[model samples]
Target: MEIVQIVGFGLIAAVLILVVKEQKPLYAFGIAAFAGISLFLLVIGKIDAVIAVLENLSERAGVPSIYMATILKIIGIAYIAEFGAQIVRDTGQESIAVKIEFAGKVLILVMAVPIISVIVDAVMNLLPTGG
Candidate 1:
């Protein structure tokens, strides 16, 4: 069912792109944009399902829920950032798209720093102090 929807969307997008090449470029762009968004929305549900499975597995393994949540957040950030960047690029705003990508990387780094600092502190604490 999922595969069928995906293939159908692709076919529609391709046909629209070809048709729009001559008649109405703007509408073609709109169709392409809608197609991309529709595909993303379709796959988003699968992503949620995958995350649920991951969370359940992590819980069974006694892994921290915070870790699982953080992982999912990172994935979400990447997906959104990439999607926005692509749209910007599609509209011929390459510079803006570059900035968007940069911002996304910076945001991800900011979110990751605390986890990194915690790990560093833990490792440091494990070391024996030399009097």
Candidate 2:
């Protein structure tokens, strides 16, 4: 039911944007951006719930809190960057949108470095030592 409402809202927004785009392109862009933001906000609670579940599972698995936090931040960056890129793309800025996505990928890789190092260390420890 909630998904239906969301879809309906999105469809209505799309129609409104199309109708206004001919006479007022700026308004059409505004409509698309607003719709994207509104939809993001609506799903925030669900996102929080998922994060809570992941945190609990990580704790149970004895994963360090820092690792979990870093993972969550990476996820957040990906989502926020994609959202921003979409909004900019709506304004017909393809290059800016691509740049935003590129930045997000770079940031995610940077954030992942510590985790990667830890994994490499663990793997090295598991290997046979040279006599």
Candidate 3:
């Protein structure tokens, strides 16, 4: 029911944006932004459950909560960076959007370093010692 309303609202906004963009392009951008935020807000409610499941699975697997949290943060950064990049692109700033995406990728890599090290060490342990 709610999803239907959100989809309907998004469709209406998109059509209205197409109509108004020629005469009032700024207004169209505003409507698009509002719709984007509204849609994100609707999805945020479901994200909580997803997060809970991730947390539970990590605990069951004996994974450190910190690593799980880091992964979650990385996912969040990716989403926000993509959203920001898209908004920049919509404003005709392709270069700036590229920079934003690049920075996001770098940040994600930095955040994964600890997890990467842990995995590497575990794998190395699994190999028989040369000595």
After aligning candidate 1 to the native by TM-score, how far in Å is the CA of 40 from where it should be? 0.4
Better of 2 and 3 by lDDT: 2
Instruction: Please provide, for model 3 over 1-131, each residue's C-alpha lDDT reduced to its tens digit, 9 standing for 90 to 100.
Output: 88799889989999999999999999999988888888887887888999999999999999889999999999999998998898788778999999999999999999999999999999999999998
- Which residue pairs in candidate 3 collide? none
Runs in model 2 deviating more than 4 A are: none
For model 3 the TM-score comes to 0.92
Which residue ranges in model 3 land beyond 4 Å of their true spot?
none
Residue pairs of candidate 2 with colliding backbone atoms: none
Q: Is candidate 1 or candidate 2 better by TM-score?
A: 2
For model 2 the local lDDT of residue 122 reads 100
Q: Candidates 2 and 3: which is better by TM-score?
A: 2
Scored by lDDT, model 2 comes in at 0.96
Task: Please list the C-alpha lDDT of all candidates, in the order they appear.
Answer: 0.85, 0.96, 0.92
Report the Cα lDDT for candidate 3. Answer: 0.92
Worst window of 10 by summed lDDT in candidate 2:
43-52
Candidate rank order under TM-score: 2, 3, 1
